[model samples]
Target: MKNLTDKEFEQVIFENQLLILKICSIYCESQADKDDLFQEIMINLWKGLRSYRGESKLSTWIYRVGLNTAISGFKKRKRSPFIQTEELPEHSIDPKLQANQNEEVKILYHAISMLKPIDKAIALLYLEERKYDEIAEIIGISEKNVSVRIVRLKKKLEQIITKQLGG
Candidate 1:
């Protein structure tokens, strides 16, 4: 696209920034690490915007690029132990957040913590309301595998939540 305006670019970032942040939080082991990862994803997004070919939805492209960036960032950070992360930035808790949903969200994070590295990516996409097909494409997995993993993950998440709450 020619003559892309700055406002349009900023709007795209504004709309999807939360999605990137959530993905990093769910995947990274430490708060500082997540923040660093988030920055990397944002930078990659900005850089990749120019290469947009309209082959897929903007969200889909972002998912692919952000995830690739996350994987690479994780690898880089693994090699560098000097980086220290602070507490993760807090999002506003919804005023209407129910007690059960609050507990579930917490336990969900716990479940996410227990997921394997790649599974964390799948879980993040699913949580963001992505279709299995889209997730499969983003992660280079078969659609069937994505479907199967989501089913298994749902059960696994429930078990973790149950165990955490002494159920």
Candidate 2:
């Protein structure tokens, strides 16, 4: 693949910024940490741009880089054992929806935060309505694995949410 010019890189970042932010938010608990992770993902995306072969959809490529960067940064940082019930990064939620569904959204993201790194990635992609094939591609897992994991993740998330709501 040809090198991405500064303009091209900027355009790509602009288009996918929300996706990256979502991944960062899922992997991080605080705005400061999310900002740090977003920068890391951006740097990795810029560095990896030349290596992108267009073998997958551009968004899929972004997801792979974003998730990899988030998970790597997550592993390097220390975290509190308890799940953070704080709101997700502001950019991660729609303000219109937030007005009506704020608490439920918080609970959902809180439940997601309890997931392991790989499982978190799967959950994020799944929730984004990504296809099984695209999710598998981004996750570097087989389609069957993606399907199986989605089933299990649903059950687990439901349990977490139920427990969190004290049901």
Candidate 3:
């Protein structure tokens, strides 16, 4: 049928998978957590698409819905039972910089982990190269707010990183 179950929906999902995956990777604490977050995003998008009128660009709607999915997903994951290290994936990084790469990424993610959910979304989207307007639109905040939050978030991230580095 030309309704909820169709190809166009899949197209939208496939097209946006990278954005969804990136958001999950940035927000989630671990690989299994990331996968759960991604699923939550997809389910929300699928559920929300039915009511998407033409008032907004499809990309805009996707951004909004996806961002909300991530925010709520992060919250749920926080309250739920989480996996221990044994549940983590064993994906390998580059051997040349393996030592430093994993440590730096873990540190970076740990720093990001400390942000409030909304600020986490803002910082993650900022890191994903979204324009200020797009970030604001996705976040339901003003452009100026996006900028301010980012500056504050950067300082917070710096503090976290500094502490992690034992400074």
Candidate 4:
């Protein structure tokens, strides 16, 4: 497979930025941290592009690289404070519509944030509707293990949301 030229790389990242951000959101608690993780994922993706051999779908490769970078960032974060010179700029998709959905999404993300790193990755992939085989491939786990973990994770999320809502 040919390496992506700089423009091609930029376009790919732009098209898939939301996927990267979703993974980041699962792993990061703060908007500032999500923004930082997104940038780091893009940098890592660019660097990893050269090593692409078309062994898996491009999206799978992106997921592997992004998740690995975020997990690495988690380790680095323990030793140093995250520094930010400016606050993340906010964008509203639709005021009323977003306001209604935001609370539920926020609660779900909070619950996901409580998961272990690998569990968080698994859950995010499941939520993204990735097939079992694809999730297994990306996570380097057996398909059956992915199934079992996702079952347990779903129950865990139910418990978390129930507790959060005092149900």
Predicted model with the maximum lDDT: 2
Ranking by TM-score: 4, 2, 1, 3
Q: How many backbone clashes does candidate 3 have?
A: 0
Flag clash pairs in model 3. none
lDDT of each candidate versus the true structure: 0.79, 0.85, 0.75, 0.84
lDDT tens readout by residue for model 2, 53-82: 989888999998898888775556446465
TM-score of each candidate?
Answer: 0.80, 0.82, 0.72, 0.86
lDDT, model 3, position 115: 78
Show where candidate 1 strays beyond 4 Å: 1-3, 81-101
Tens digits of per-residue lDDT for model 3, 38-72:
77778888887777775767766776777787776
Superposition TM-score, candidate 1 onto the true structure: 0.80
Tell me the RMSD of model 4 versus the true structure: 2.7
Report lDDT (Cα) of residue 62, candidate 2. Answer: 91
Looking at model 3, residue 19 earns an lDDT score of 78
How would you encode candidate 4's per-residue C-alpha lDDT over 5-26 as one tens digit per residue? 8898889998998899888778
TM-score pick, better of 1 and 4: 4
